[model samples]
Target: MSSQPAIIVSSLDMDRIEALIEKMPRLTPEVEQLENELDRATIVAPEAIPANVVTMNSTVRFKFIGDDKVFEKTLVYPHDLKHDEQVSIFAPVGSALLGLAVGQSLNWPMPNSQSRTVEILEVLYQPERAGEYLR
Candidate 1:
């Protein structure tokens, strides 16, 4: 089965989303349901998770659609991401990638019918000393 376990938005990322949902009452049922789903889901507090997190200067193994090779590149967190490698929280790929563990695979859908498969091989280091995404 696909490892993509429903996109659970972190509370830190949902601060703005919550406010926007409140202001925009015209949202459709599905959108409103999503907000409720997020509200119901307990956000895992930022703690030291046992898994490794991607950080600045951390080495990682990742794959993309076009490239046959499993690229080994040093990750630059919070910044320095290329179009394919660097993903921001607000970006589609970025939202899908954050907080992934090694050996975990996820299939993410693109705007088109295309899909991207991602797997984590190694997490060289964690930029955050504390938090669920760090360990």
Candidate 2:
């Protein structure tokens, strides 16, 4: 909603996400938002992604700006979403989290027309950082 903080995405993840977007049945606002994010991201090789940056399959801990309760979730693709804690990149919050580094915050619009600020507290696990680039 505001000027977004710069984001970094790994090349592997970028390819995968672009493919996923292409396979979607129809375009939606969330999808468009994700596309916008991808368009502006700084893409690099998977091995070069910073350890703190959130990538596909990363387990991240974050919280709403005014909320004290933190949430830890794994960022997954649509088909990989089987658990309540898994977030699909097509979801607003999930899209917002992509490529974000720890300590970055984003003002995310909600379905109800309200906005919530999401702050990244930590990246507990990142596929690139763990050397699982293909995953």
Candidate 3:
């Protein structure tokens, strides 16, 4: 995999994600990747996060590199994931999407033994921006 761009995450989200990681007896690669990303992240206070940065409960719009298909999902905690519109932080795509800004793209690993690229088209709603920091 190519080098990932530097990313920022909120301190609250970081704490919650770390606790989640600790609860798992075994870590999947996708979850491990999320842990690693958090380790290297520029952690900031909830109110300090930029409006465009993806945070927990943020609604993101993105598209695959070659496909014309676009998708919008809310990044959520594992427990909050209820349907296709929500993406759990434990998933590979969810891990890749966190902290990404509009226009940033991540080359994500897939179960099919191939890499797929997804570019952030917009951050439709971010918790920090909406003043829903504690959510």
**Who wins the lDDT comparison?**
2
Candidate 1 structure quality by residue, lDDT tens digits, 1-135? 233443333344356446655676487543444454455444543443334643333456766645677766554323455655544333334433445566655565554556677666676554443332421
lDDT of each: 0.49, 0.91, 0.88
Residues 21-133 of candidate 3: C-alpha lDDT, one tens digit per residue: 89999998777767777887899999999999999999999988999999999999989999999998888888888988898888877666777887999999998998987
- The C-alpha stretches of model 1 lying farther than 4 A from their native spots are 1-42, 53-60, 65-67, 71-85, 129-135
For each of the candidates, give the backbone clash count: 3, 0, 0
Window of ten residues with lowest summed lDDT in model 2: 106-115
Minimal lDDT window, size 10, model 3: 106-115
Residues 1-135 of candidate 2: C-alpha lDDT, one tens digit per residue: 248899999888889999988988898887887898899899999999999999999999999998999999999999999998999989899998999999999887766667788899999999888889778
Q: For every model shown, what is its TM-score relative to the native structure?
A: 0.50, 0.95, 0.94
Superposed on all Cα atoms, model 3 deviates from the true structure by an RMSD in Å of 1.4
